[model samples]
Structures are given as structure tokens and as C-alpha cells.
Target chain A: MGAAKVSADHPGIDELFALLAYGEVAAFYRLTEEARMAPDLNGRINMALMAAAEMGHFELVSDALEQRGMHVQQAMAKYRSVLESYHAQTIPSTWEEALVKTYIGDALAADFYLEIAEGLPDEIADVVRGVLAETGHSQFVVEEIRAAVAASDQQRSRLALWARRLLGEAITQAQYVMAERDELVDLVLSGTNGLGQLTEFFEKVQRTHADRMAELGLA
Target chain B: MGAAKVSADHPGIDELFALLAYGEVAAFYRLTEEARMAPDLNGRINMALMAAAEMGHFELVSDALEQRGMHVQQAMAKYRSVLESYHAQTIPSTWEEALVKTYIGDALAADFYLEIAEGLPDEIADVVRGVLAETGHSQFVVEEIRAAVAASDQQRSRLALWARRLLGEAITQAQYVMAERDELVDLVLSGTNGLGQLTEFFEKVQRTHADRMAELGLA
Candidate 1:
């Protein structure tokens, strides 16, 4: 497509990309800080590794924005409030909570990014695919969650409740974004049958969560 | 040299390496945890990056141990008490203390590692060089320290006092290790006239700290 057509088609792509970039940067910052909450040296190192990987994503998205003639700092500033509020409202309180946040939050982020990637141009899609392929952080989260669930019945119930709470908070914060950013909401809701696509998206996420919970013997 | 001859010549290399490996792991844990003391996201992320870089050192040392048919976990266990005690006693209470600990401690670590690397085998030296090459964390600490020192005269004096306290605690910890682990101390204190080399090492570190203080206009 021509430049004009591409710009018209993906009106809010820059904003969305910028928002995701800031999200990655914030994740890197928060995860690294939270890694200290680990009780053991090994756990701490592994969490740090996961946090560092988020920097790789941040650099990739930032570079993409630069390539598109957008200043990264300015773009990031636009969505800092939304991103910061999300983190502020969803701080993990325990190892289990942290793992649940990493697992559920990362999976949802990957799904959303993947959906957007499919709609973007080839170069942007390529960058997203590259990031999506590096699932080390999510894998660590999954293993930890499964291990925690398998260790004890009481722990499983507690963590399952925590996971549900994290999901709830995430949805609440996401709604804030949707309400405030009309262009972003419109872009996401476009090319779908009203709220049906969104409902299906939520259902798919719930199904995935159920599958994970069953795998961990929590469901 | 033959394996037996090499072991005999570098009798305490294993112990020293093991202690250093455990130190890196512990530092990674402590620094990652200490990142939370940061007053803002930027400071937290900077500390996190430093912690993450230490994990790279941990992996390198762990792999070096494994290559020698040694289990990293077993080696790490040998120095656990010493490493734990050092961190437990020196936990920073404020941002200034954290910055001093990161800046001065990391620089001292780099100097000590560089000194020790000179006497190690080629394979071990290469690992040390690789780990030392990433100085982003050190740069971040320097920038932060400089900014803090410039903020106010009182801030500079307070941070200088904190740095001295950290150094005193570190020396006490080092002496404890030296008294407890003669072999490791011997490895470090070897190749020079007994206490002279040890004294010179301390003096070198002191000079480096002075230089850093001068750079920050705090001296």
C-alpha cells in the first residue's frame, strides 16, 4: 500500500507501539527490582535474567519507533501515566503472586501484541515476532507457577486466588486505557463484529488460563 | 603443565574461584533486592541492570567450575556463610547508601577481579575479561553518585560517611574471610612479599575511591 494508505489504515499504530515500548521498559524496571524478593540466590538470578530480556524488547520497539521518525522519549511520555498506573495498581506481594503476574500478564501481552503484529506492516510484524519468540520469562513463570501449585494444596488455592486477582486488576487498568485512548480502542475494536471479538478474546484468555491451571492441577 | 602439577601450583585456585563465584551470586541477589530502595523508576532500573550484569558473571564462573568437573552448587555452598554475612550486615537504608554501595563496591570489585584475573589460567582469565567488559552498571552508578554529590554539600558529606562505613564493614568481612580461609587468602596474598601485596591492594582501592570522589567534586 502507499504511504498515505498505510498511515490511514494504521492510524494509531505509532501510539500503540509507543505504549507497548514503555510497557516493556517498565516491566524491565519492575521485574529487576522485584527479583530481590526471591528467597534464594538462584531464584534471584533467574528473575534478573528475565528482567534483562525485557530490555531487549524495549530496544527493539524503540528502534522501530525511531525508524518511523518518532522520538522515543516523546512517544514514551504520552503513555507513561497509563503504564505507571497499571504497575502501581498491580504490584505483586509474594513469590507466587509475582510468578502469576509474570505468567498471566506476559501471556496476555504476547497475545495482544501478536494480534496487532498481524495487522501491521511486515517490518513491524517481524520485530514483534522476534520478541514474541523469546519466551524465556514466560517459561520461567509457567514452571514456577506449576511447581508452586504442585507443592501443596493450600498453596495452590492461595496462588489461584492471587492469579484471579491479578487478572481482575489487569482488566480494570486495561479498561482505563480503553476509555482514555479513543483511537487505540477504535483501532482494536475495528474490523471485528462489535464487542463479539473482544468477548472471544477474553474467552480465549480464560480458556488459556484454565488450561494452565489444569496443567498445574489447580483447576 | 599436567593436571596434578597445575593443581599443586595453583592450590587454592578452586577455593578462590568458588568464593568469587558465590560472591557474584550473593551480590546479584543483594543488589537486585537493594534496587527497591531507589526513590524513582530510573534509579531502580539502573540498579537492576547492575544486578543483572552480575548474573552474567555468576554464569561464567559457574560454567568455569563445571568445566573442572566441580558442581557449582557444592562450590557455592562452601562460601555461603561468608557471602551471606557480608550482605546481611551491609544492607543500605537509604538511596545515598545504596548509590555508594553500588558505585564504590562495584568499582572495588572490578579492581579486585582485575588483579586476580592476572594470575588465573587463560580460560578463567577469558571468563573474567568477558564479565568485566560490561561497565554500563558502573557508569550508571557513577552518574547517579555525581548527581547526588552535586545536589548539596550535606548530601555529599552524608554519602561520604556512608561510603566509609561500607568500606569499614567490607574490610571487617574481608579480614574474617582471610582468617577463616587461609588457602583462599594465600591465593590472593601470594606472588608478593606477604602482607605487602595485601596492603598495596587496599591502597590501590583507596586511591581509586579517592579518584571517584574527586570526579564527583566531593573530595
Candidate 2:
């Protein structure tokens, strides 16, 4: 899991690249899907821009994976079923729900990638960092959520619940991903001293999630 | 009606811009949705590229609408429902159906825009041309549909029927759009000599659609 094990054929490094590649492309599509749920064309267009950003990252990471001789499809295949089922189980029912899901989901994935960046090779970490740089909340997203929450108490409570549910679902999916992929588990474990640090790492992530929710007035 | 009528307040110009803006963004989302149904991640990523192209046009047309001193929302408002219902009614039932629909639907739109480009002011026509230029069938899409059709007689027939249904539904929706929007009728009419040319215009457009289908082996 350390930079010493960051070669293309190394177990966890490939999995990490595969995971991020699929994750970026998947996010691109998911954001486009959610854009339709936006209240208006402007909202939808803004979401489209965000989706386009994800597409850029997708190309970058997929290109990096290809440079490693890993076919993008072959790399993505292993995680496809798990990610599909996770998305199926956590379908957002409304525009606000979808917005929150994308926000939290992106942040969580970014956090995971950043956490593992320590174990990745220099170039790989740089590419991963480049992808995460765009994962922060867009201004329009914050304003939209804040304005919606300000307009209605029901929206506030409902969105707060949605945020919490997103956290739980994301954790469940992440844990499932870690458990299901032995290479990923090894990659992650190799980086950490023990399970205690990993548990703390997640708690730290949740704290950041709560802070983000607070920023949107959904805390 | 003519270049002389190309102003910010013109009736159909706004509608045209609005319709196009919405159409491009809608295609962006729809293509992203369809990308998921692709047989593999590589296919999905290719669809994403096509979707991204639509997003670029969406931005161009949308920016043009804004420069008209018309709010994009207001410009696109009249189209929101009609396009929504059009999509609602013409929803593609499968990946092949979606592929054919996008391929055919985009070609039809490019034809219409090119047909009407003569009546537009030079600048507006230039913008319209820029957007339509990308409307030509992408090579990958042609290859994909052709491969599918070549693989099986059932796919050939199935996609042929889908193409035909797309043409029908497209005509139905265009008629609805024409009848419901008084300005578009006036706009289309003012650009031409009489009802005869308009009917001829549609027939010509349909001819091109057939040609595109043949190119995909779905004719």
C-alpha cells in the first residue's frame, strides 16, 4: 500500500486507479442524471458544468490507467455491480435529495482517495489530488441548498435527514467496497497502523460531513 | 422571419434559442442516462463524450439567449412543457433505441437549423451553424449502431422500427410545437413563400433522416 508498492501490477494500486476511474465516470453520469431534477434550466446547466468537470477527471484518471496497460473496462468491471447496487439502493427521490447526495457522495469519495493518497506513487497521488480538487462544493450548490432551507422548515428537516441518510449509505457502501475487494483492503491496511486508525479516519470524515451540512444550514 | 426581424424581442428567435438551449441540455442529460445502459464502461465513456458535446452546444446557445437581454428561463419557458412532453412521449425503450433516437433526432434538428439558417441574420446564423455543425453523426455512434445491426437480423428490424417511430414522434412533436407557438409558424412562414415550401421543407428533412438511417443500416 506504500509508495514502494505503487507499481501498475501491484494489487491495491490498480484497484485504487480502477475505483477512481469508475468513480469519476460514474459521477459524471450521475450528476447529469441529477441535473434533470434541478428546478430550472439554469440549475440544470450548472449541474451540467459540474458533470463536465467530472468527465475531465474521468479522462485524466482513465488515461493514467491506460498508461498502466489496464483497459478501462477491465479495471471498471469489478466495481460496476457494487456501485450499481449502491446507487440503486440510495436513489434520491427529489431535487434537494439528489443535490445533497451528490455533494456528500463526492466529498466522501474525495476523502477516501485523499486518505489513500499516502500509499500511492507520486504521480498517482498527484493525479488523484487533481481530481479531488474539483470535488469541493460549488457556490451555486451551497446557495441553492441554503436558500431552499431558508424558505421552508419542512425542507430543512427533510434535507437534514437526507444528509444523515447519505452519510450512513455512503459508509455502508464504502465498507462494502473495502470488504469485497481484498486488494483494496490490503492497500488500505498497508497504509494504516491498525483498524483503530481506520475507524478514527472515518469518524474524522463524518465530522467534516457534519460541518458541510452545517454550511448548508442542514445540520 | 428575416434577418431584418432578428432582434432581442423577436418572437421565434427567442423560441429557437430557448428550444435549442433546452434541447442541448436535455440531450446532455438523456445521453448520460443512456450511457449507463452501454454494454461496457468504454461504451459508457464514449457516450459521455457525445453528451459532453451537447453540453458545449447547450452553453453556446444558452449564452446567446442571455446576450439577447432575455432571461434564459423566460426565453425557454414556453418550450419547457412542450419539450418535456415530447421527451415523455418519445422515451427510448433500450440502448439501441436511444442510440438511434439520438442519431436520428440530432440529424433532424441539424437539418431544420440549416434550413432556417438562411433567414437568420449573419451572426445568429453563424451561431446556429456552429451548433448544428456538431450535429452530424459521430463516427463511433455510426459504428456502434451498424455493428449491432450487422450482428443480428432481429436488431436490424428492431432498430429500423425504432428509427421509423422516432421520425413519426418527431413529426408529431414538431407539429405540436409549430401549432402551439404562433410565432414559430409566423417565423417559418415569413421566411418562405407559402405553405407549399414549408411542406416541402419537411419532406426534404425526412429524406435526410432516411439517408442517415441507411448509413446506419437501419433503413
Which number leads on DockQ? 2
Q: Between which residue pairs do clashes occur in model 1?
A: none
Runs with alpha carbons beyond 4 Å of true place in candidate 2: A1-11, A28-49, A135-137, A151-158, A185-200, B1-11, B32-48, B133-137, B151-158, B180-200
- Per-residue lDDT of B1-219 in model 2, one digit per residue for the tens? 333434435578878888888778777777877676787666788888778778778778878888887798777767777766766777887887878877888888788877776676678878888776773337778888899989999999988988887788778888898898888787777665558878988999888988888999987
The RMSD of every model to the true structure, in order and in angstroms, is: 4.3, 3.9
DockQ list for all candidates = 0.33, 0.49
Please state the error at residue B13 of candidate 2 in Å: 2.6
**For all candidates listed, what's the TM-score of chain B alone?**
0.86, 0.91
Q: Top lDDT: which candidate number?
A: 2
Considering just the first chain, candidate 2 attains a TM-score of: 0.92
lDDT of 1 by residue, B1-219 (tens): 111112333656667668778887777667767777887656755665676667667777777778777777777787889878877887888877877787777666677676666656666667767766664657667777788778888988988887777667777777787788877677666533357667887777678877877775567
TM-score of each: 0.82, 0.82
- Window of ten residues with lowest summed lDDT in model 1 chain B: B1-10
